[model samples]
Target: MSNMHASKLFDVKDKVVLVTGGGRGIGEMIAEGYVSNGAKVYIASRDIKACEATAARLNKQGPGKCYAMAADLSKYEDIVKLIDELSKKEQALNVLVNNSGANWGAPLDEYPDAAFSKVMNLNVNKVFTVTQKALPLLRNAQKKDGVARVINIGSVNGVDPPALETYAYSASKAALHHLSRVLASRLGPEGITVNTLACGPFQSKMMAATLEKFEESIVGGLPLGRIGTPEDVSGVCLFLSSRAGAYTTGATIPVDGGSLVKAKL
Candidate 1:
């Protein structure tokens, strides 16, 4: 009966999780959620210093431990090195959050080709490759209850076209959404679940520039009448990572505070 309780349903204690770009922003929020709830969280970023600093801070508040590993996920060699490093630390991984991404914004006419390429490389290609490489580990971690999970952090801009001109970022997230569905179907038989968290405006360094310009307008437009908070993102992650979300797969769940619906109206 205790196992049927809400707390037990959402329990992720002692789970092994890897969150890329986990040094800050949405990634940091997810890492903090898991760490605070007693999950051994490995947070990685291209910036080693940021990752180490974040790990140090999260470790102090944690029921579980946080570790930092740095890798530039855009390159195949670096991804390989990261997988190797992770393998040395843990034999299995219960969750993988593909949250590392970049955005390039410019007038459509002036948008550089390099910006699109770079954004796509990190946001789309890197996500696919990293998940592919992590399959063995994910498979090993599959619980008898079929609970291994891969959570892709997508954007609401992908579902609803943005008012802003971050062309590549929007496109990449849409692609990631489709990719999550495809992977979910393929991995279902392996007892691994794949899902996308389609998110809206949140307070992250990536959103700082845009929020600085239109925070009020953005909040006003939302039916929820506010920007997303860290708890908003992490609560979704907790559900998707734990038993509560075990039966959900190939789904794109919007953690957007009703922004997508409001945008359509």
Candidate 2:
């Protein structure tokens, strides 16, 4: 193909993308990026006001286009409703971004079982359930490329320990990574791609709260000598969902800026 056509490798024109937890932070950035690239973006979260506000602001910002839908991913009923509602609005579901998650940190000895369950419910169980519920929509929308795209938001902690106490969070992310690989294998013939975006620290609500408890030494520990940003996280998702990443599936692309390679002397 010509270079002009090649530039269209990452094109998402008219595609429909659903981004959970897209009301703010990393999810919001990904939603904006997709909208800029010509996709009809949908922002989903528990906070209806925040979702609507983000949609309005994004609509104000050329080619700005998106909608906001409120649905608690942690709830099965809500997931069904979301899938049903979106199915009615769009003919094909091109992308699904599982970004809604929660975390809690405490010394292992003091970690509460309730906290662990809560985090896992949202971080892991919800991811699996939402994807399962959305699978039909994805299947119905697969192109000749033989599938739709599913992006699971993972964490650097899923690969290595960072002295953090997010026990359930890390484990859940690890499971998500593994699950993505499994889905890729089983769903390949069905024409869908599944991948994980293992991300590094950024200006997220979870990171902001953790930063308050940590120190600058944390950033110093990263090989890149700086923390990651929302762009860093969203860029990988964009690539994976685009034609540029069509051949790639069952891969965990780490957007950690090489933080996982760091070592203590």
Candidate 3:
């Protein structure tokens, strides 16, 4: 590919995108990346005000636009309502980024059954249901030559379990990664691509407490010698959503700056 062609390969301009849990943290980073690049983005979360605030903040920056929607994705009806509202405005969706998730931390014996259930329900189960309900829009966006992208945000902890005792959190991410692979097999024939982004620690709401305490240790531990920034995950997402990554599917691509590599060393 020529320079122009190569540049165009990573282009996501004007594409329609929906990012769940896009209120803050990694999801917000990803959303801003797309919006800045001229992709119309819809960010949905249980926190309507937060989503709206993010949408407003991004919209101010502009060539691409962003809209906000409220959906407690943990519930089936709310998922349907969100899709219904989106369906009212747009007929197609080019990129669907499932970033909404939950985490539960507890010791092995102290882990509550209810907490486990809640974590599993929000982190694993809801992702499936949201993807299921959005199939029509995803299909609408698919092309014979180009496939729609479904990037599932997962954790590096899923691949290499950390010392932390967030049993359900790790397990849920692992399930999500496998789920992406399985869905890839089924959705491939239908002109949609599925993949998991096995991400390392990023400065996000989820990792605030851990990072606050162990920022130095975590930085020292990583081969990259730094934690992830927005560009780290956003760049990978652009690659996967654009023409460049059309052929790549059913794969777990890491944005961990070689954390997994450091783990074995």
Candidate 4:
């Protein structure tokens, strides 16, 4: 095949995609990538205003379209409502990005029970619930030669010990990574793929405080000598969602600017 044909391998044209917590950060970057590539994208979040604003902005730059909806994934009821709304909007879903997550930081002894529970509920439990509920839609979206995709947003903290005190967050992400493997094995025969993106650091709201506090040290320590960019993440997401990554599943890919590699060194 020609290079042009190979380039088309990553095209997600007309794919129906849902990105949880797609209002900002990595989720927004992923959503924008799909929208730019002609995928019909639905970005959801607890904050409707943020989702709407992001959708509006992405739509202007799109070959596809972006829609916004509000749903708090921490609540099972809200997850169901979001699915129902999505079902009304589209007959099937080609991609599901479980990007809605939470994190809490404090000294181990000072980390309250509520904080731990909240992080686990949002990061681990909700991700499972949302994926489970979306299975039917995923199945519906599966093409005879194409597979539906489930991309979970994990963290390097799950792979390596945290540099700071974020115990619950790390544990939840570790669980998510494991769950992705399990789901991949279960969903493989059904023409679906499940994978996790173990991200390092980026300029997201979640990392804003940490980056501000230790940007110099973090950047200097990284093997790549810089933080990750939206393009770095979005490119990987597109690859995974497109035919280029059709044969891959149950894999934990680190889009961490070699942070994980340096951790062991």
Candidate 5:
């Protein structure tokens, strides 16, 4: 009963968090949740303008502050630079959200050779690399009673065959989900936790084209009868980062409104 209250249990106040690809889309939503709840959030992306703009906007709604940085994390050098920059600003990192990703769609017969490598590199390889580079900071945030968090934003496509033919995207996310399990097992003993959220359809730029073309069909097929909202993603994020979720590691919780369950029509 000492910390049973929701405020104390789910509090992320003053936690140093770094969210990559946070300039827009799902990243922006998650960042806003932390900043508004008093977590010192740092958002990064390759687009300097978007990063700067997002930071500026979120800072205005703060009990916590948001910082912006630009880095193309697909490259090893840039990953190193990003971590170095964050290290200079913060001695420790309480949460690291590996949210930036990419996708490519094409018929299997016409898929380009470079699509697999490029998409996989950004969606899977770079996440591992960024987490590796950020280990020291994560370690510093670790403690006997609490742990550092690594939240990888994944897709339900990884959990099931997607409605679209985003082959490489599905493959990469599946790989990411497994990778999170491996990392979680390896790091849990050291006061760190790694988890992935197998998201369903959210209103993201990444999903914009598909939604525009098939909104009705997609909504109709979902068991919950709707797509995801910003609150849906943010609420899950806060839970995972808070004390309430400290015991969860290597989990791939779905944020999809039971879309993977399919409608029983």
Candidate 6:
């Protein structure tokens, strides 16, 4: 395939994207990709200092500018405030990536109620709330190139439960995946696209901790030799949020390196 043809498949130039939990790890990588591609990127998270640091570093890069905001995704009021504040600065949000979430792992009998609630509040509730608050901006944004996109960060644990027990985290992510499908159906006609990225074992803070305790033998079970990377995860997000991804909605794309095909037995 020609370079131009491949380039035409995905382009986010001159667009505005808002990414939650974008100060570091997977979110930061995705933000960098968008900014490098000529799309103005806004990163939102609870850490004001981290946000500022990332914004400062990214602002020095070319093509697109980076902005940062401090917003706790677990709270509805905070999301409202975040949207209101962004509206004051930018015209509208062209893309929203709900990448902020917390996970808890415990055996079913040992899991506490707080584990479920805490993860759900940030992973699920916040997704719905933030999307609702950003609706006006998304609804009014120009769709000449493509409809506004909403990319929810999910987990492969939601699809196939590994022996490692992450009861609440897996359940929450599963619910989030389902929620994306539901929202996609309702928001499609409004020129908005919704989808979820079910990521597998990546070199993330969450994964590092899990890796220390888990058996290394499982590594050989993966079809891909190594675990996932920031590029592995962010590449998919960029595609789903760019013009090339306009036609994809109500979908759950995996960045798992064929791990989803592993034998359940």
lDDT of 3 by residue, 200-247 (tens): 889988899999999998888789999999999889999999988989
The collision pairs in model 3 are none
Q: Tens-digit lDDT track for model 2 on 210-234?
A: 7776647777778887777767776
> Candidate 2, 19: how far from true, in Å?
0.3
Candidate 4 per-residue lDDT, tens place, 88-200, comes to 88878989999988888999878999999999999999999999999888998995336599999999999999889999999999999999999999999998999999998
Worst 10 residues of 6 by lDDT: 138-147
Instruction: Write model 5 residue lDDT over 1-265, tens digit each, in one string.
Output: 5698999899999999999999999999999999999999999889989989999999999988999999999999999999998999988999999999999999999998899899999999999999999999999999523659999999999989886889999999999999999999999999899999999888888989999999999888788989888899999999999999999999999998987777355
For model 5, name the residue pairs that clash: none
Off by over 4 Å in 5: 263-265
Instruction: In model 6, state the lDDT of residue 90.
Output: 72
Q: What lDDT does each candidate get?
A: 0.93, 0.84, 0.91, 0.92, 0.93, 0.84
Give the better candidate number (3 or 6) by TM-score. Answer: 3
Model 6, residue 72: C-alpha shift (Å): 0.9
TM-score each candidate. Answer: 0.97, 0.94, 0.96, 0.97, 0.97, 0.93
For each candidate in turn, give its C-alpha RMSD to the true structure in angstroms. 1.2, 1.7, 1.5, 1.4, 1.3, 2.1
Residue-level lDDT for 228 in candidate 3: 94
Looking at model 5, report the run of 10 residues with the lowest lDDT sum: 138-147
- TM-score (C-alpha) between model 2 and the true structure: 0.94
- Using TM-score as the yardstick, the better of models 1 and 6 is 1
